[model samples]
Target chain A: MAEEMKVIYERPRSWANKVTHYCPGCTHGVAHRLVAELVDEMGLLDKTIAVWPVGCAVLGYEYFTFDSVEAAHGRAPAMATGIKVTNPDNFVFTYQGDGDLASIGMAEIVHAAARGWPITVIFINNGNYGMTGGQMAPTTLLGQKTTTSPLGRTPQTNGFPIRVAEMLAQLDGPAYIARVSLDSPVNIRKAKSAMRKAFNAQVRGIGFSMVECLSTCPTNWKLTPVESMERIRKEVMPYFPLGEFKVAQGVL
Target chain B: MSDKVLMKGAEALAEGAIQAGCRFYFGYPITPQNETPEYMSRRLPEVGGRFVQAESEVASINMVYGAACAGVRVMTSSSSPGISLMQEGISYISGSNVPCVVMNAMRGGPGLGNIAPAQADYFQAVKGGGNGDYKRIVLAPSSIQEGVDLFVDAFELADKYRMVVMVIVDGLIGQMMEPVEFKTKVDVSTLKTPEWATVGRHGRDHANVITSLTLDAAGLEKWNLKLQAKYAQVERSESRIEEYQMDDADYAIIAYGTMARIAKTTVRVARAKGIKLGLLRPITVWPFPAKQLQAYAPKLKGALTVELAYRQLFEDVQLALCGKIPLGWFGRGGGVVPGPQEILAAFEEQFGKGR
Candidate 1:
């Protein structure tokens, strides 16, 4: 008996053939690959500009094969707004982390969404501040222990984790908003679907679209890669409910 | 012949930027400079340009940063506190070598001192306000007409050097009305967009990456040295100063911006009293006219550096003269404008041999 097999899956043409700087047990690599694959599928490599954030992705331009610019801490949304407004024909998006977008950049992202800016935002919500030594971030769970919250986050001291997708969906301007997680194969496939939908909304000239990915930082969370994925499924998924919150009336 | 139009300093500067081919403006409303964004909002749309009233000053400067990297002439105007908020973004822009124009309609400071006219931010303007070894091509305009002219020149200088160019004026100039002549307009077609701009991948073979993070120490050093070389060239080629009635004079007053206007009056009163006095007004403060001042150092008995802040500009004058000529300083602060009589009295107290 003879068997024949064909190779179908490979790296996207939009991604540079190089190693990432993210630590082991980190899901940023997966997020990056998904973006590259989607951008390649949509053929947006030639007319896309990515705004990098000040967190671990400060050197993100090195991994992407498209035009990119680095923004100061918490300023990516503002920079993205300007780029989209000035170059409306090009595809523009901002890659930001919870600390960069939710903590210091709250105003920038909120206003950009409210203005109905035609751009995409890929918000990575990894409960802890992974870049700065496992510090407490705006998305940290209620009882999660971080460097800044050593005694474990208490309601009296640290407030509840921010539900970004829900908050942004409340704004009347966004065309599509969804929260997804990368905890398991089933969730990951769903995450890709949500991302693809968000990118499609942007391509169709729909107003601001955002995809919030619940990612895992095992090293920072002090867990194995397997355990971290389980944590995202059990702990982070409950508070940050997944699914589409706002799909513009006609944008589906 | 050109027509003279009566306009506020803010509006004149806005019109001048348009003539200079500036196509994008991002600003937040602040006193003494609110009219600038207002003027741009109404005029930019007519010319196919863009304007955005940003969420905050921090957001506005970052917007300018993005537009600048996209290969467009952009600007943002603010006051003292707002400019302070923009320092971090300005540092990023300077480090990336993105060409843009920023105008600071300075009001009283040291912490929201007042809304009145003051030169308290002279040090923050000429020196590097943000972290890094960088300098802004600071232009100080004493009159509304001069502000318009300087605004036009700022765009060219920023493009040619690929750095931030600043026009620092007091609240008085921003709010006051004066007749200004619009005689010149730089050809927008002649301006070159560098190969590094992120205007898409149509013409270039590779994607452009605009960033300031040089993680390697040696790499960062090389960039800093390149910036220093450009600054050296600017110093040699762009130093500008106006010397008034310096012929056969013994006492000279070194001033700039609104202080220069007051010093002009001081020169008149001192000369009327039979004292040989003159004025040296610096138009470009960063590439300071130190060479011109040095040329007159031997001829003058002494010099008085006048400013709204206490001894801020005096530090620069001293550095330029380096003790070869004795320098005296006098001024008022916290939005207080020194009177001509008060300045004349200070000049006599310091340089007067009989008094």
Candidate 2:
């Protein structure tokens, strides 16, 4: 008997029915899925406005079913601040990369967290600029080598890497700040949990919330997807340090 | 007519914006324009609107882009240096085709020039200071009253074209006080919300996505063409010029903003001396008043571009004339505001050179 297999798992309704443009083995797919699934589960798909930044996720609108806007390079925090302040009833979140949030957009992100704007920030730290072809990002480890840093980054030449979760946690404004990794299934589940907490923090109208996802970029790193996960687990996790930096009362 | 109340130009412009239904104001304080944000901070809360003093001009303009994308009337104000910081954000806003108003209370600058009145930013205002092919509808108001009145028109035109609109004034106008009557009450409910605005779906089939990135060259070309068509329509329907004593004159003085006010007095002085000079004040600087200036070009011997900058507005005057008539230029820069006497001397310089 030819029995039809029942569908146990499927795409979330909040995600578009199309192929994403992410590179092979890129964890942006995983991050996007977590966001879409949570948006659907929380019944915020209709009232959420995702502010995308100028990075690998610049075309995020194509994959999201809800309303989205594109911010200029590194200006997503400021844009999200405007959207959240004007439409207080709507949920606004900014999905940004290390280059977008911690580099040129440093001022915007700092001020947004300092102001305690009730918005969620999903920070993807891949250690290098993924869209611009493997340039050293602000989150690049001290000794990591990139296209721009062929001889490996030095403390004097490249400066110390910014720990965004820890930096933002110092501000009195943010309600929740956490750093999570996606190097394995256990960490992937933990990353999703952190994102859900960040989203709920916005829903509670507590303050700004951010989840720094230690993602992978096999194409930029010149490594296989398996090796990339190994790198995140071995190299990136030690430097980035996974844990909640700040948790507001009742936010989690 | 309503009773005119004494108001500073910046304060009057703020009132005008509020009346035009601008519910969100995000700005960083700069000299000569700080009063605008100060006024907004006090007034917006009364109307259940929001006012944010941003960290920098860069963040301020992005905030305007954010609020504007969510289908609200938003604005930001700054002086020349601060405005330069906002160009990148302005380019993004225009590229994304959002409606908002930016006010520049001009001061002299290639750098941090003094916080005095100057119209040196004419080129930056009209000639797409930011990267990419985009146009901003620029309105230059010479007086406090005119500046106040243009706010209503600026927001209306921004919504009508779904593009950026600027109300440009010099620092003098921003700081000076005058008895102004804001009689026009715009009913914002009558205006249609933009079809593309990102208002979260209460009950809609799809969501609105506002973005400027069109990676495909063909897709980007299509977007550029749409912007060009809309700009062409604006150029045809919204060109504004005020001709003073242009009917019987042998020479025309082309100016705008504070320069136009000085040119008015210059025209009177020159005409009293029977030099047969007239004034062509452009209210809409981007549209350039080219057609009206061309019509009077045949009757004039030559045109003189008198401005606060070295030769910014003169370039536009030359473009409009297209070498049909000889052009003369004179101006002051770096926070120097020329008087009617100084302008009259420049007119004599042009007349002397012609002979």
lDDT (Cα, tens digit) per residue for candidate 2, span B186-226: 76577566778786776678989999899999999999999
True contacts kept of each: 0.71, 0.80
Show model 2 residue runs off by greater than 4 Å: A1-8, B189-192, B352-355
Number of clashing pairs, model 2? 0
Residue by residue across A124-204, what tens digits does model 1's lDDT show?
Answer: 999878888989999999989999999989889998889899999999989999999988888888888888888877788
Q: Report lDDT per candidate.
A: 0.89, 0.91
lDDT of 1 by residue, B171-221 (tens): 888888999888787666776777888877764679899998999999999
Error of 1 at B99 (Å): 0.7
Off by over 4 Å in 1: A1-5, B187-190, B353-355
Each model's iRMS: 1.0, 0.8
